[model samples]
Target: MPFTDHERAYLDAQHIGRLATTGPRGPQTRPVGFKLNTDGTVDIGGIRLSSTRKYRNIRERPDTEVSFIVDDLEPDGPGAIAPGWGRGVEIRGRAETLTDTDPPLAPGAFSREVIRIHPRRIISWNLDPAAPELRGRTA
Candidate 1:
């Protein structure tokens, strides 16, 4: 798998993530609901997703490179100075715009339209205490 056990678990538990895509004007990012597919691909979808810029970007650029991140602040532990600890995983790879053929990531919450991400590289931080910070590797 591209993701470690901790990274996969974190992604499975999280409902929202940020997807970055390059468009005509510039780079754009938006909060998105995603599903970790059985094949280790990330699928992002939302209401009216087909009309969104991210979708257009993928459709327009056959080789659309994208980045996705799911993260949250970790509660402070004993002896912690402040409550600013963070943990998350980032997936960077190519994206494809899929329409009508795939099921929604969240039934009723998202449409059949989705942006499927094939991970080329994975970056994770603080997911496992034994793991190093900002650890990254090719998928």
Candidate 2:
């Protein structure tokens, strides 16, 4: 699997993530909504997805690499401070623009077009309570 059980669980629980991609101008990063596919790939979709720069970046250069991350601060104690513990998963991979796929990733909120990321590397931190450090490896 591209992700460990803990990493998968963390990703599955999160709704928002950030995607970074390079375009003619430069690199661009934006907040996005994603879904975890059964094959362990990530499917990013949004309103007017195909017209977005991120989607155009992939469509322009099919091999364009992308980075995606999902993270949050979790309370460390019953009354933890405002800044809590940090945990997240980062995925780096090549992305492709998929248009008119079967059932849309998110029906009402997103379009049928989506950016699918095939992970080549994965980095995770604090997902496993037993190990609270950054861990990375090629997928």
Local distance difference test values of all predictions, in order: 0.85, 0.86
lDDT of 2: 0.86
What is the C-alpha local distance difference test score of candidate 1? 0.85
TM-scores for all predictions = 0.90, 0.90
The alpha-carbon lDDT assigned to residue 66 of candidate 1 equals: 93
Candidate 2 per-residue lDDT over residues 25-130, each given as its tens digit: 9999999989888899899988989889989998998877899999899766653323477789999999988888642356876788888999999998877766
Report the number of clashing residue pairs per model: 0, 0
- Candidate 1, position 112, lDDT: 79
- Could you give candidate 1's per-residue lDDT for residues 28-47 as a string of tens digits? 99999888987899988898
Model 1 reaches what TM-score against the true structure? 0.90
Candidate 1: give the clashing pairs: none
